[model samples]
Target: MGAATTRATRGRRGLPWLVVGLWVVLLAVAAPFAARLGDVQRDRATDYLPASADSTQVAELQDRLPGGETTELVLVYHRADGLTAADRATAAGQVAAVAHRHTLTGTPRGVPSADGTTLVYPVGSNEPGTDEKKRDAFVADVRRLAHGEGGLTVRAGGPAALATDASGVYASLGGPLLYTTVGVVAVLLVLIYRSPLLWLVPLTVAGLSDFLARAAAYGLNQAFGTTVSGQSAGIMTILVFGAGTDYALLLVARYREELRRHELPHDAMRAALRGCGPAVLASSGTVAAGLLCLLAADLNSSRGMGPLGTVGVLCALAAMLTLLPALLVLLGRRVFWPLVPAHGSTPVARRSLFAAMGSSAGRRPLTVLATGAALLGALALGTLSLPGTLKQLDTFVDRPDSVTAMETVAAAYPERSAQPIEVLTPAARADAALTAVRDTRGVADARRGRTGGGWTEITVTASAPPQSAAETATIEALRHRLPGSHVGGPSAQQLDLRDTDARDRTVVVPLVLLSVLLILAALLRSLVAPLVLVAAVVAVWGAALGLGGLVFGPLFGFHGTDPGLALLSFVFLVALGVDYGIFLMHRMREESLRGSEPAEAALTALRTTGGVIASAGLVLAATFAVLTNMGLVPLVELGFVIAAGVLLDTFLVRTYLVTSASVALGRRVWWPGRLSRAPSAAPRRVPEPVA
Candidate 1:
């Protein structure tokens, strides 16, 4: 018997190393692919658009045209007071030089402002084709050569130049975003554990998970033709660290408790996994399900993000559950250092902060619930203050050269659109399409361009500035009049993005709600409990967006909101906010299963799980908040709202409102489940908890 016990101990000791060895092989396999994820990333506006949109069709047709899509740019030479002959001569000389170097569609033509302050040359090139790198190079060269002498300001602006700047911003996100997120998670872990060695384990595991997630994302792009954008990949990275760290925190907390009761570290790890595994799995499932619901969206960007985001969550979960546990057990309880939990040792007796909060909630459940609901309702009203959909010029937080150039052009050409509106019509009906474009009310000029692949391209300039209501009206009229033609351009693409986002919201929101509701019901086996959770998350989302409205314009100085904010924020807040909900409610239910009455179970669950939830919530919110420091307005807005929402949901909704509601509902909170019928058995004596 002694020999057999020795052998069993040896086997237990060897298991963790085997787990680590397996992960080493998996990591080796994933590393190469992960390095190549950025190579496949596509950041073009057309890449994000639905194939059915008119603008998307025009873009596709242009790619098949005579020169494989045109690279258009506008060179602006302006003097504040007025232009002199030397300035005009300088502009003309620079335009000629540009034409000499690049294969332009026609002779360089300069349009002078009525005030004689600006000389603008519309430059078009087809030599670079639709290759992003080649086009960026071409735009870069033009900017390099087109310099102003003396007081004249020379700037480059147009679709190609704008795209180059946007791509540059996107390309720069991967490194800084990763570094900031890692720093944030590491600090939170250090503070949460207060053990130098202990904080390293989960952070290392999460990094591996993020690397694995990138590899999976690359594979998805290769196999499924998934559109991997810089934004999507950045978002995937955020999920891997944020959600991954969350699971690690919960598991470590449980493992520390088990370390006190069990002698062997391996035994303690196994017991901890069993104790918290269900809640963690259910929490991850809720997030994965909500993300997958985005597959129903018509917007390609949103649809493709669904699978990639899920891959991130699942990878993080896989690493934390397997790799994280193995490493923790292998390191032994000594890894916890000063705060190590010794076998048979009692934890320091102290009241949990959550206990006090839970007590207040239990004493006046209805009043607490009502007050929370009212507060959330009031916050929701702030959405009315949100600015209109963000425009291209206002998209970036830091001013890009193209944005500055465009702003100058908008001021110079106030009465005429600087950007041409492209219309693709059947080659056989070219004349009719041309006629319709010319007859459009807001069109200042209409001209026929290249014809190929059964389509004819017509370039039309709006009498009003680009993206103005007058210009939009003209495009709409052209679309109505020329049914067979596709009206498109930069402005048209923005319009399509807005309309598609609106449509996506109506479809995806309901599906996400249903998916979350169904998953919660399966996990809890209770109708009322699932509804309560779903309602809580929805309220949280509304309040978060309302908070955005209150600050985005007045506080942040943003001119407009990102069109996708409503849907994206809704999905994230509901899914991630429910992550804490699962942690709290699952614990509450566990207490009920142990024969505690609903009210007692609610308070007990909060008192126990609340600290871990708070830690996890803070880590997740901080990781997202790093985006606020990003260069783009959209990233900042998204980060601020999500981070704020997580904090609110963590301290307010999950701790106070949810606990009070559960206390008020009692056993009926588990309606139709066996617990609703009666306590499983006589009330079991509760144990002293580390939390």
Candidate 2:
């Protein structure tokens, strides 16, 4: 018997080493690919556009012109007061020098603003073509050469310059974003575990998962020419840490409970997996499914985000399920150190905080449910205060040189468009297109600029500022008036972004809800329970967005809401909110399966899972909250909404509202399941506690 026991001990030790060995191999193979992920990230405006958008077609066609995609810029030379002749000469000489230095499309044309304090020079070149690197370099060199002196302000602003600045911000986010997220998760884990060694295991595994996610993303880009925007990549990293850590917490909590009941570490680990594995798997599946529904989105960034997010979640799930358990088991019970759970220990028991809350909720279920719903509804009304669609200039939290220059130009030249609308028509219809463009209602100026590869490029200047309703209408009118010609440019791109985001929300929202509902129904085998979860999450989403409306504009002083915020935030909130719901509901189902009364089961489930779920919620919310400190408004807005939604879902929805609803509905919550029917009178087999 001793020999057999020794052999079993050896067998138990063998599996963890094998798991660690496999991961080491995976890390070695994946490191090189992961490091190269940043190299493949694309942040160009067109990268985010819908595949069939007119602006997308314009971008594609321009890449075929003689010089390829044109890198256009407006050099705004301004002074607060009226410009002197010398200032004018300085601008002209600089423009001349720029013209001499590069192969410009035409001599830089100086368009004096009506205020006379600003002189704008529109510069164009195809030399940089479709290459983002060359284009950024060109913009950088121009900015260096045109530096403002004395009272003069010389700034490089336009679509190309704006793109470069935005890309720069995206590129810079990798290091800070990663470090902040890691630090956030680490601190949270340390506090939750209170064991120096225990917290490190899950954190380390999550780090490995991030590496694996990056490597997988790089592979996707290589194989499918996937659009890996900086936004999508950053979001992917967030998911890896946020979702991964949440899974780790759940596993660790269960393992701790199992350790107190089981003698051997191996047995404890196995039991722990049985306790929480299904819930974790269901939560991860729900997140991945909801994200994958982005495959139906027309926008390139949104579509790519679906896969990258799925990769992040799956990688987290894989690492948490495998490496975390293996590491914990290998380290044995001592990993918990000062707080170790000794074998077969039954200590003094007391009601936990969640237990008290659940008891209160159970006592007055309908009142609690109605009150929570009312609060959420009131918050949802804040959506009415949300600002209009954000303009490009307001994308960043801190204004870059391009934004400053554009603002200056707008102040100086309110009546004329500083940026031109680009239209591409078939070479055969060039004259007719030009005539139609000039005759358009808001046309300030129309000129045929370049003709090549069967297409004619027409530059039409609008009478209003960029992204204004008037300018939007003008572009639409041009599109209507110019048959067979594609109207595009910077303003056109923003319009397309707004329109496509709206369309994507309409399609993807329903799909996400349906997929999540299906997954929950399959996992729990209850139609009513799944509906309740979905409806709760939907309320959380609305309340969260409303909270953003109250904060983003009034409290935070943001200019406008991002065009993609609605769709992305909806997907994340609904999907992630349901994760906690699954945790609680899964536990509730387990109790009911053990023949406990429905109301009793609801309270018991909350008592058992509530603390861990709260920790998971805080960790997830805090990790995403890191983005609120990011420089981009879109990142901040997205982070705020998701984080706020998570908090609402966690402390309010899952804690109070869901519990109340479940207790009030009783067995009907599990309609069609065996547990829904009346309990039979038989020998009562009390359920063993998870511990």
Candidate 3:
């Protein structure tokens, strides 16, 4: 009998070490590939475009042409008053020097603005071919030559130059993003745990999880030809640290409780995992399912985000559940130091903030519920104030040289667009397409530019400013008149982006709702609970967006909202916001199952789980808030909405509204579940509050 008991004990102790060993081996194998992930991230416009977009087709065809993609630029030399004789001579000498230094399609001609303040030189070269690095190098060389001297300002602006600037920003994101996320998570964990030693454990585990997620993402890309971008990759890292540390906090909180009840550290951890594992699994599963719904989106960036985000979340879950437990058990109770939970001890009694909140909520459940709903409804109205769809030149938080030059041309040439729209048609029908383009209503001029690969390229300049309604109408006219021809270029791509975003929202939003509902229904075993949670999150989303509308233009000075902002922010907030809902509801259900009265169960659940949920919400919000510091306007908007939504959901919606709703609904909140049918009975005992 003693030998049997000893064998069982050995088996129990052996498993955690075995799990740790396997993870170590996995990390060792993944290290090399993970380091290479950054090298493959592509941030070009084509990477994010819809697969069937005309711009995408044009880009692909251009890549297959003899010289590959042509590098296009507009060199703008500006003088506030007017160009002096020397300024004109300087411009002429530099244009000659540029032509002499590098290969050109033809002799560049200078077009003088009617105002006589700017000289615009349209330059094209195929020297960079299809290589992004070489293209950036070429643009850098040209920019060096196009410099301001005295009162004249020379700037390089065009599609190629803009791509170079964007790529530079993407390249710099890796180190700063990672370091900032880690630093943020570490500080939050330290503050939440309030223990010098305990915070380090979870932060370290989160870092390891981030590394593993990157490794897995790289593997997916290599095996499946997955599209990877800097934006998606950066968001994935944030999820790893944010979501992983969240899970860690829950587990650690539960483990601390279990330690006071069980005699042995190993036994206590087993109890902790048993207590919180399903909630953690369900939370992570819902987030994963919600993100995976992005695969239904037509946009490349949105689709790619689905897999990368899922990888980050799942990796974090794995590390926190397995590695965290192993480390806790090995380190024993001493890790908590000055505030350790000694064997056979009970937690000290204290009046927690959540307890006070629950007491107030329980007193007037319906009033609280109504007030919260009204507040959310009021906030949702802010959406009407949001600015129009963002312009390409306004996508960056700080205007780059390309945007400045584009602006200069727009101001100088208000009657005509600065950039040309590219039309690719069959070589046999070149004359027809060219004639059709010229005859288009809003076209200022149309000219045959390049012909190769059985295709002919025609460049059309709009009579209106770029991305204006008039320019868009002209593009539509060209597309309608010319069959088997694609209308492309920067303006066309922006139009395609807006259209795709609308299409993606119609498809992906419904899919996310359905996926989250199914997961919650299965986890909570109730139809009403899932619906309540979904409705709450949706309200939170509307309010968050409305708040953005209020501050985006007036407060932050963001001119236009990103096309993808609404959809991306909705997915993240719903998935992540519902995370806290699951934690609270899961506990509420557990209390009901233990035979606590409905009101008692709801309040107890809030009192017990509220602190941890608040901590997790803060961590998640702070991590996403890091995106606002990035250079791109879309990222900034996305970060702000999500961070704001999480805070709203956590403090107001989840705590006050959800708890009060549960209290008001009583057993009906768990409709069709056995607990709802069971007669009201006394709970076994009131749980002691943990510090």
- Model 2 whole-model lDDT (C-alpha atoms): 0.90
Question: Against the hidden true structure, what lDDT does model 1 obtain?
Answer: 0.91
Off by over 4 Å in 3: 7-11
- Please give the distance, in angstroms, between residue 391's alpha carbon in candidate 2 and its true position after superposition: 0.8
TM-score of 1: 0.98
User: What C-alpha lDDT values do all the predictions have?
Assistant: 0.91, 0.90, 0.91
- lDDT (Cα, tens digit) per residue for candidate 1, span 1-691: 9999999999989988998999999999999999999988888888889999999999999989888889999998999999999999999988899899989988878999998999899999998886888989999999988998688999999999889999888888899999999999999898999997999999999999999999999999999998898888999999999999999999999999999899989999999999999999999999999999998998888888899999999999999999999999989988999898999998887887988999999999999999999999999999899998798878888888888888888898888887899999999999988887888799989999999999999999998877778888988999999988899999999999999999999999999899898999988999999899889988988888899999999998999999988888889889998888888888888889888888889998898888999999999999899889888888899998899899989999999999999999989999989888984556555554575
Question: Mind giving the per-residue lDDT tens digits that candidate 2 earns over 289-353?
Answer: 99999999999999999999999999999999999999999899999988889998864476578
Provide the TM-score for each candidate, comma-separated. 0.98, 0.97, 0.98
Pairs of residues clashing in candidate 1: none
